[model samples]
Target: MTTFLLFSFLQLAQPSAIQFTNQDLQLESNSGYIQLDWTAVEGSQYILQRSMQPDFTNSHTIYQGPDHASFVSGLDNGTYYYRVGDDEGHWSDTLTLKVEHQSMPLALTLFGLGFVVFAFTVFVVIKGVYTTSQS
Candidate 1:
């Protein structure tokens, strides 16, 4: 009876695993933001950590609250590592994210094309109104 009780007590004392809800965690994003989510335990707050290294060296806590999801934005283009942990210090497996935004030249070209289209549309509208009123 004592052995059984001891084993049960040990089991209860051990921390539960923190698992990320996103199974396909390795992904790339062209956007500047991402939503990080994980499984949450009722009545327990969680800690969200981010690091540049996959090994979690020099990791810093990005969030610590009861919320299970975090919206992270304005991230520069690079590789990022994230992990979620419970208040008891049980950490989940790391997730890797790669951010590669569109090139500046491409963005500028799109803008110029848009401006040209706008100018052409305005010229056509003005010419049509002038011809109708003159006739």
Candidate 2:
């Protein structure tokens, strides 16, 4: 009698809807890469697509598996659009990612600053050594 009651209750329960976390749907940008992370549902495969245009007419699938995150690198500086979907055809809202690579002028300025600091440090060390020897 107890086994029968437990089975009846289990069957009456409804499973909750599967959805991705809002926070996890955001796009993350780094120096040389862009990453998309999301909460994955069990037994469901996700499809990730990207395109340079907002209409996604030329979008291409970058990943189609059961992974929780995707990464893209070596992309030129520009705006990109991304969207994620499940095998069931349920797609999340579109998100935008912007990439800005470092320019050559900025790189040269940083290199010049580093060289100046290094030269000053060497000069300070040599002056201290000469003074100690004379004393």
Candidate 3:
């Protein structure tokens, strides 16, 4: 079938190497969310794998795509291993991460809100100046 031939061709065309940059990992809201990000690969798809054990015998796929990153949500406080690979079976270096629950300190939250207000005020002032100059 035509679909079969196309699939074969794509398999052959898959690259052997996929490099990732700008790798970032974060846990939001006390291990409630696991957000993973990486630099996009130039010409390859990504297969994201995860395992609870370091040995990875119980690994499971989190995603597969060319997007180069994924977020694994609803993970409890624990350690996890991750890796990204190309369709050709070439894999980048492995990464290990731990998610920990964190409570938002009231002081920090207030400070962040203050910063947002200050930024909005500055933006309004700049916009007013620009409009006046244009007129």
Candidate 4:
């Protein structure tokens, strides 16, 4: 049947491998997320896996879809490994991700300093306005 032949042709178009566009990534100290992208094949489904080990023995499947990109977020500070593959078991080179968030105390200190500056600015602005109205 025509439908059977079309399916056979699509199967024959299976790509030999999948390649991620990015090299190993290191997130900024305050960033917790990034977007992952890879080359895609039409009519083919891809799988993205993440692991703590280079061998991917304890890997987790993070995405399975036909899209070429996925958004990854909310990761704690650590190192991670990732790989992409098609339904035909063709996998690309492994990519590494390193996440290091800013320390809580340092972040709080910066926030407090900003608040102080803002309060001072507001006070100065109000005092200027009051003096100008009285003049």
Candidate 5:
């Protein structure tokens, strides 16, 4: 009798009208920042939260807004988990974002190549000098 009553109550409850979808997580340029976004929920305000660990041992609220976009800055260079909740108590599935502090620019790549060549030349010169001294 109790089980039937519980089932009937569950059926009577209405689901959340505000639905979240199309969650996207991405990095912001070369900075160690992450951006969490999702499909706009109708008639609701978005609440964004982030966590450093998979289990969400430490969670932080990043944003609360009705806008379609949100940006989170000063993130670590690793993976982060985020979730969105609407004002109507509808929460979304967690999204994962990856942030990279250093992106290899063309100029930086060329500079690195130049430094490698210079280092090799210096090493070769030192080796030659040592060999001559030994002889």
Candidate 6:
């Protein structure tokens, strides 16, 4: 009887593991930003951490709240690692986010070059027409 009681107490004292409703987390990328979404336990405070290293040795907490989704922006093009943990210290699986932001300066330069070419073509065609009419 004592052995049974001890086993029951031990089982009750064991910490329960935190689980996410979706095992496979989804990552969405937008221009200049990335969004992380997951189905988590309601009313639970979670700590969101990010690191440039996959091992997460230098990870830092970006957010600590009850929200199950987070948005991160203004990050340079690179791979980032993220993980979430509850207040009880149970951590979720690590998620990898790869960012590839388009170069704004390059885009602007291409647009400007295209506009100049178009304007030059239109001017040449108009000049040729005017000269032929004069002739």
Candidate 2: C-alpha lDDT: 0.77
lDDT of 4 by residue, 1-135 (tens): 999999999887865568888754443434778788998878889999999998999899999999999999998898888889988788988888888889999999999999999999999999999999999
Q: lDDT values of the candidates?
A: 0.91, 0.77, 0.73, 0.86, 0.71, 0.79
Better of 2 and 3 by TM-score: 2
Q: Per-candidate TM vs. native?
A: 0.83, 0.67, 0.53, 0.78, 0.52, 0.60
Predicted candidate 5 versus true structure: per-residue lDDT over 18-124, tens digit per residue: 33344344433457654455778456688887888866678887788887567677776778877777876677666777766665587699899999999999999
**lDDT, candidate 6, 67-106, per-residue tens:** 9888878887778888888888988778877777667898
For residue 7, model 4's alpha carbon misses the true position, in angstroms, by 22
Highest TM-score: give the candidate number: 1
User: Model 3: residues >4 Å from true position, as ranges?
Assistant: 1-29, 103-135
lDDT of 2 by residue, 1-135 (tens): 999989888865633233435464445454657667766767778888898888899999999999968877887777888888888776767777777778889999999999999999999999999999999
Worst 10 residues of 4 by lDDT: 23-32
Q: Candidate 6: global Cα-lDDT? A: 0.79
Task: Report how far residue 27 has shifted in candidate 4, in Å.
Answer: 6.9
- Arranged by lDDT with the best first, the candidates are 1, 4, 6, 2, 3, 5
CA lDDT, candidate 4, residue 76 = 88
TM-score attained by model 3: 0.53
Model 1: residues with Cα > 4 Å off, grouped in runs? 1-14
lDDT of 3 by residue, 50-84 (tens): 88886778899889888866877877778878777
What are the candidates' C-alpha RMSDs?
Answer: 3.3, 5.0, 10.7, 5.2, 12.0, 7.5
What does candidate 2 score in Cα RMSD to the true structure?
5.0
Better structure of 3 and 5 per lDDT:
3
The per-residue C-alpha lDDT of model 6 at residue 88 equals: 88
Off by over 4 Å in 5: 1-30, 103-135
Evaluate model 4: give its TM-score.
0.78
